[model samples]
Target: MHEGEGEIHADWVLAGRALQDVWILPGIFHGTTLRIPDAARHGWHIFWSDPLHHYYGRQLGRAVGPDIVQIGRDDTGQATRWSFSDRMPDSFTWRGETADDEAGPWQLVAEFHCRRAPA
Candidate 1:
């Protein structure tokens, strides 16, 4: 697998109730994601599309802990999770995992220990 660096720009929209993220992978893939909270369900509805890869999907994200948000999609029997941890003022860890089913023996797909870019 190829390992490389990318940048993400996030913004709060819908009167700060929703989050939108734009990812730049520089010739690999670029995508935009929107996350809107579903208070009744205690989770967020996630929508993303990456035209370069011809990929798009929807997922549900729920906070697993104070610093970790896990998102999963169950429609295809291929669930994916993204966990955030080790947060600091200028850095954090993001891990990606996947499983054949929602009841997972998850396999790690990627892990990024990210730091703030120099201003």
Candidate 2:
């Protein structure tokens, strides 16, 4: 990621593991999965930091970001649980489901309120 004063970037490989503590300055962003000989199976999600409390660094009580989740998977690899948070805005949202198959439709799993602890 780059802040635009000068170009700086870093690359990471997500191999179906949850990532935490990925902090970077907001800037242009792009993602791609290449199929050299065949496609690979992987899962990925990003929970941004609470910019207002950047120093807290995702601390349980002081940090927050758009919270997205997925539950059971269908045969076609669609999420049986899909939800988005409007409380905390995010630059972008992504769900792994694609349009290649029409066998399954995304289903909402649950609804709940989120609150941050006093800073």
Candidate 3:
């Protein structure tokens, strides 16, 4: 993977009330390595590099396609679910939300990475 940066928004809530809304304006990645500049403030394990890239890549048997990773955490800062989906050389769409009750179920956010096909 190439070097990149992105944003992260974490909502810390309890009993349906938002306690904190933390935003990491810039998340960094270099050569498939990921780092969260404000991880300490946002809470532990709020974000990280895809640890299952090799496993999923092996399962798919090829590297050219869209790979998706989904993560869900509850209000108590516990991971409730984690999953991934991939598509090969075509348009695709995803629906639904996170399964964790403490984490509000809302539409998932997706990031797409595409490069030009060779001639």
RMSD of each: 2.0, 15.9, 16.0
lDDT of 1 at 17: 90
Q: What C-alpha lDDT values do all the predictions have?
A: 0.80, 0.31, 0.33
The regions of model 1 sitting more than 4 angstroms off are: 74-77
Between candidates 1 and 2, the lDDT winner:
1
Q: Candidate 2: list runs displaced more than 4 Å.
A: 1-79, 87-103
Worst 10 residues of 1 by lDDT: 68-77
TM-score winner between 2 and 3, please give it: 2
User: lDDT per residue, candidate 1, 29-111, as tens digits?
Assistant: 79888999899988889887787877676788887766766667634547888777898999999887888876788889878
lDDT of 3 by residue, 25-104 (tens): 23432112122223344322223334333211111111123434334453344433333244445432322234435355
Q: Residue 67 of model 1: what lDDT?
A: 73
Task: Score every model by TM-score.
Answer: 0.85, 0.25, 0.24
Flag clash pairs in model 1: none
Predicted candidate 2 versus true structure: per-residue lDDT over 55-105, tens digit per residue: 111101111245543334344343344333454532223233323333456
Best candidate, TM-score? 1
Superposed Cα RMSD, model 2: 15.9
Which of the predicted structures, 1 or 3, would earn the higher TM-score when compared with the native?
1
